[model samples]
Target: MGIAGVLEDARPAAAMVVVEFIFSALQIFIKLALDDGMDVRVLVAYRLMFGAAFLCPVAFLIERKKRPPLTVKVVTGLFLCGLFGITINQNLIVLAIKLTNSTTIVTALSNLTPQSTFIVAILSRMETLKLKKPSGRAKLTGTLVGLGGAMLLTFYKGPEMKFLRNLGHTGLSHAQGSHQQLRPPPAEGSRILGSFLAITSCFSYAIWLTIQAKVGQVYPCHYSIAAMVCLFGAVQSTLLALCLHRDTDHWRLGLNIRLYSSAYAGIVASGSAFPLMSWCLRKKGPLYVAMFGPLIIVFVAVMSSIVLDENLHIGIVLGAVLIVAGLYMVLWGKAREEDEQEADEPKAKAVGQDEELGKETTAVNGES
Candidate 1:
């Protein structure tokens, strides 16, 4: 490969790193909007709608000529992907952050997404346990460790991280006197509930990841599919938002954090981020993309510490270690499995070639 080829190969890796930063910023933005007292439902609705508006035109221009027809089955699948993937996933995420009052929790839990996806793949018969193989064993161990980390994060917060807490209070001085102070941070029960919501949100995303393959198979137009999902999710989220909150004032976005966060979430996070991810997925495969998962957690932890002045706990420290360790183990196993398969291919081909040559010689001898 020449310079161009090398650059092209490196592009996805760089893009994924940027994507993780975008995602980390997204959580902070959403949390900021929530702190500003914008209703979560309203924010989600606006976000999906904004994403749709940004993406629909691009999809139409790029894929309109070559895109597949939107048949009933395809539309239905897209709708469900929107419902479970975008609508449910986005809403639950916002709610979880609101309850936890910490972006770190959400980002930490997100590491579970890959594990959930792996489990879903195995149960759906797309993959084997391969428990007998070292690669498989690594993957299994990784999943268990990751789950243990999540459980630890949820159940035990450990001692208060006083230094970090002090940093948060200092960082948040300007953000004080908002509705945030009026409503006390979540108690134990609320924290547990928030953790549950975050876990459920991760599963919802995993389900989307798995089913998107079927949608992609039929549509084959990634841009168009994303546009449709955003459009559908917008509609679903708006209806739900209206049902939950009747105040028109809450829907209005002034020159404030609420508007800024919504715009960023919709335009940058949903609109731009999705396409970049699609590009990376096509270029580098899911494993390569997944290997970057740990980056999001790191980004979020740092951002939260600096931006939200959020404190870290012993549980968070310990849980992050386990989850990140698990993610690498799983990715490593997958890499090895792929490498072994690739190595076997040439050997198998050589064996077949030798058999063919021997058969040709035998035929010639018989003729003589």
Candidate 2:
């Protein structure tokens, strides 16, 4: 392949890496916000609202001419998407971090996203698994390895990984202090609860990724669907928050980490990241997008140790190692699958597909 062809192939991968990095940073911010006593419900409500505000206008202007009609199926799918992706998924994530008193733990569990997605896809007949094929075996092995790592991460808390904690605390904790807990350590029950919540969140996220693919298949307007997701999530979560809290005190926006983190979550993380991920999902499929989950753990591990005074225990370090190993195995399998699929296709059709892919950047700016 030529330089342009290579760049085209690399673009989405690079975007996902950047998005995951942003996610790692956002985990730190949200942990800080939650530490400062921001309620998870309130945080989720405001985040979706902020995301809706940022994406609605952009989606409208960009997809104005070619936007598809909002069919009932698409609308219903979007509502569920918002619920799974934003409301339940995000709240569970924030609460998991708070309850566990450790961002790294929650992050480590996210490695299960791709594994869950793969299993769900197979059950739903969206994908097929052939044990005879090397690629299929690699994919299965990767999922099994990742699941084992997640189990280890959950059940075992070995020695603290002091090396990670000593990495970049000076910068992450400049506003606070060196190597300090964001709050008092939680009870054992809360940690277990948090681990369960984190696992649920990953499954919810996997379901969202699957639904998003289906939604995109029906309604190709990326930004519009993303905006709808945020808007619906905002409305749903806000109502839920109101039902629980009744008082408006928690809804008040203040000029603090809560507001900053919420805005960043909504605008940058959800608003910006969603459309990019949707594009990648359309291009490389859900498993490709989900594979990036393992990368987030490493980033969160370092950042959590520095910013949230989270200790990377032996379980975490070893689990992360296995997870990363599994990630690459899955990625390699996917790559081989794609290469074989292309080889099976007519050369002219492959060239045509590449041409369309070459238009990816322009399409991102134009369609989405």
Candidate 3:
């Protein structure tokens, strides 16, 4: 391949890493911004609306020339993607964040997407089963390891109140009351359930990505498709938020830092990221970009610790390492497969040329 081809391949990987970092930080920001005074449902509604509003003009300006004709088929696909990807995914994710820390939520959930993508793609006939290949085995094993890590993160809570040992040395005794008020009481069972819900949300997102891959092949206009999906999501999410939060006080918008956080999530995380993700999927394939989801967990861990002043527990570190290791295993397997395929190409080409020459010679002999 030429230098340009190498750079082109690297671009999507680099873009996805940036997207992962932004997405991870967005979760931590959202968690910090959430308060008992605000309704989670209302926040979801605002995010969708603001995200759509941010993307609408850009889509119109850039995709105007290449826009696919609006048809029922395209509209239906966009609506479904919007419903699953935006509405359900964001709702469950925010609810999970409300129940748990962003580190746990992002870590467990992000790890599930690749496996879910594989499963949904296989079921939808978008991906093939290759049980015979080492790469296939590695992907399967990596997925299982990731799930195990998630389970360990969710189910196992280390010894409770252990921090009391260092209370005197750290001068935590004086700040006990304030710390208690600042930290939400931990609910192990509830948080485990929330983690499960987050995993389910990841599955829904994976299915959306797999379906969108096929849709993009047919439409080839990422901006238009993503804009329409966001618009539909904004409408649906707004109605749902209104229904869930009937009190007018909850609907009131205020000029605050939380609003700024919402704007960042809407404009940068959703609006810009969504279309870029679609374009990357079209150019690099689903597996290529989907592999970066696990990195979000690391970003969330680092940012949440810094911003929220959360402790970097041993379990969190171990879980993060396991998730990264599993993700690398899956990506390594994919790379090996690509390498093997590249090695076979020349032989396949030669075989095809030989068959074609033989066919032409046989045809001439028949004519003679």
Candidate 4:
């Protein structure tokens, strides 16, 4: 490949890394905003609504030519993607953050994405196992390591709870009013359970990505698909939020920093990120994008410690290292496999041509 080709190929990976990093940082900001008494359901609903409002026009303008016809199958796929990917995933994630520490949730959830994606891909017939292939073996090993790291992050509390006792004034004050007798201080066991729920949300998201890959193959328009999904998610989330909140005043919009934070998450994180992710996945494939999940975890851990006044524990650092190492091993094996396949293409073509020529010669001989 020429220098230009190399640069072109590098851009998508770079873009994905940047996007994921931004998303990681954005989580800290979201947590801060949520700390200001924003309801999780309300936050999720507004994010979906605002994201859809922002993305629809862009999709229509950019993907006007390649937009798929509005069929029942396409609509149903979009709705399902919206429900699981945006509505349930976002709500559960915000709930996890509210219920547990950001460091634990981020680390545990980050490692689960690849394992979930792998399992769903295999079950959906998107990927196969070939134990003889190095790529296959490496992928399987990497996935197991990733899963083990997730289990450790979610289940093991280590010898000490570094951040458990350090609940700041804000968290303490918030804890006092809501179920004071029933809810106690943040416990290691509860944090572990919250981490598990976050991981489950990651698995749900992985299913969404695998399904989106198939949808991309069929529809071929990333922006349009994203727009439709966001639209459906907004509708579903709004209804759910309404059902959860009885007082109409609780749903009213407020003009404050929280509102601005919601807009930022909606426009940049949900609206822009979702479509960008889909485009990257379509062009580069799922493994390429999924490989950056651990990178996001690291960024989130650092930013959360700094911005949210959370502690950086030794366990988090070790878990992050294991997760990133495992992710890169998987991605590296995949790259090598792709390179080998490319190199073998010409040999396979030549062999097929020779076999066809031999058959033609034999036929001529028999006829003569």
**Candidate 1: TM-score?**
0.88
As for model 4, its CA RMSD to the true structure in angstroms is 4.7
lDDT (C-alpha, whole model) for all candidates? 0.87, 0.83, 0.73, 0.74
> How far in Å is the alpha carbon of 44 misplaced in model 2?
0.7
Residue-wise C-alpha lDDT for candidate 3, range 116-142, written one tens digit per residue: 666677788876767798878887777
Q: What are the per-residue Cα lDDT tens digits for candidate 1 across 77-117?
A: 99999998999999998999999888998789888887777
Poorest lDDT segment (10 consecutive residues) of candidate 2: 174-183
TM-score of 4: 0.82
Q: TM-score for all predictions? A: 0.88, 0.83, 0.82, 0.82
- The Cα error of candidate 4 at residue 80, in Å, is 1.5
**Pairs of residues at least 3 apart in sequence or in different chains that clash in candidate 4:** none
Which consecutive 10 residues in model 1 have the weakest lDDT in total? 171-180
User: Candidate 4: where is the Cα deviation over 4 Å?
Assistant: 1-18, 159-185, 274-292
Model 4, 1-368: lDDT tens digits are 99999999888888888788768856865676666777888888887888888989998999898776877777888888998888888888887787775644565465666667777778878889866888788878877877767766666545544463354335433443344334444677767777767877887898888777668777878788888898998999989999988686666777875777678778988776776677787788867787667677767765554455565555655665666666776787677779878888999999999999999999999999
Candidate 4 global lDDT: 0.74
Model 2 lDDT, residue 64, Cα: 98
The order of the candidates by lDDT, greatest first, is: 1, 2, 4, 3
Clashes of each: 1, 0, 0, 0
The Cα error of candidate 3 at residue 112, in Å, is 2.6
Error of 4 at 115 (Å): 2.5
